[model samples]
Target: MSVQGTPDELVEILRETVVSLVRRDGPDLSARQLGVFLTVYLGEGPHTVRGLAEALNIGKPAITRALDRLEEFKLARRKINPADRRSVHVQRTTRGAALLREISVTMAEAANPQRTAGTPTGSQQGLKP
Candidate 1:
């Protein structure tokens, strides 16, 4: 489904979602690491470090660093490409999928906080006067 909102509203949604992520107990991914993780999980793959760097318009070393962080969290993994042993393929893990689901829920709630149980009303949140 398509979600439409004013620019301010969109930014508020992003802010709220990020705040929720920050307050959560799991790994706190940097912007680059999160971008790389999303790209791998959301995009169709055969994803290699080279391909990610190209897709993201980032350097290979930066991509490698992001992948390293992801691997440390067990959110993604690299496997040697059998046909080309020199290449490494990025793969998603169950933990990564679960994290994505959590993010989706957070975004949804942020987008409609009034509908969420125990969420303060606009006036209470100081969004309305």
Candidate 2:
């Protein structure tokens, strides 16, 4: 059978799935905390707090607070940028990679809720959905 919900509804489901995954395994991270970690995890270059704030459209202070939590969990680290001592870049640690992979698998399972039945309803184009 074709999926019943609008694409947006499906997207919301995926978002909720991600949120739940983060909440469950990443006990130290809030949804926002996971979001910041993911940003750096996926970025080509190091991600600065300012860049994360800009990317997420959140205030710097909010990003800082999230970063603090991630650092506490050992999933992320604040490193001094070599080119700029005063600047800090966030990097995902081995622990963070493991967490990301775990969350990714959980999200994949969530989005493809019908996996066991042989039908998958993953039509959304991007990762956030």
Candidate 3:
């Protein structure tokens, strides 16, 4: 489902969503790591380090570092491809799926505060008075 809002509204939603994530007790991912995790989980894979680097327009080492953090958190895993021993495939984990769900719920709540029980109203969430 597509969320339609004015640019400022969208920014507020993003800000609120991020702030919620920051407040939660869980693995806090960097922007790059989040991007990598989303790409691996949300996109069709057999995602590889080389493929991720190319897709994200980053270097392999950066991808490796991101993957290392993801693996450390058990959000994603790297497996030596049986078909290509030289390549490693990035795999999604249950923890990663749970994180995705959290993000989705947070974004939804941010977009529609009144729909969420105990959430502040839009005006209280940085909407201009």
Candidate 4:
């Protein structure tokens, strides 16, 4: 049976999958925390505390709290920007990269429920164009 959905619907499914993965792997992280990490990780930055707050449209205090959570998990690191000792930059640690990788894999698998059906084996796995 072929499954069909609009782009938004598929995106919602993907979001749910990612949430589930996050809950399973790091229950301590809220969805907001994940969103903040992704935005910083993908943004053009120095990824400073202020930059993150501005990018996320949130208060600096809130960003700081989120950063604390990430640091507690050892998934991200914050270091003083050598260019300016007063500034700090946040970066994903090795553990963060590994977590992201595993979450992505889980999302891929969850996105396609058809896989459980045992048919059309291998790479072309019904990935619609």
Over the stretch 1-129, how does candidate 3's per-residue lDDT look in tens digits?
577999977887887787788889988889999999999998899999989999999999999999999999999998999998998889999999999999988888777846655866457777764
Which digits, one per residue and each the tens of the lDDT, describe model 1 over residues 58-105? 999999999999999999999999999999999999999999999999
Q: Write the per-residue lDDT of candidate 4 for residues 1-129, one digit (tens) a residue.
A: 354678864775666575567567464577778877777666776698998988888999998888888888887889999989999999878888787777777766756767435644323454542
Candidates 2 and 3: which is better by TM-score?
A: 3
| Candidate 1 ranges with C-alpha deviation above 4 Å | 116-129
Candidate 2 root-mean-square deviation in Å: 7.2
lDDT order of candidates, top first: 1, 3, 2, 4
lDDT of model 4 at residue 54? 83
Candidate 4, TM-score vs. the true structure?
0.73
Q: After superposition on all CA atoms, what RMSD does each candidate show versus the true structure?
A: 3.2, 7.2, 2.9, 7.7
lDDT of each: 0.90, 0.76, 0.88, 0.74
**Superior candidate under lDDT, 2 versus 4:** 2
Please report the TM-score between candidate 3 and the true structure.
0.87
Clashing pairs in 3: none
Which consecutive 10 residues in model 3 have the weakest lDDT in total?
113-122
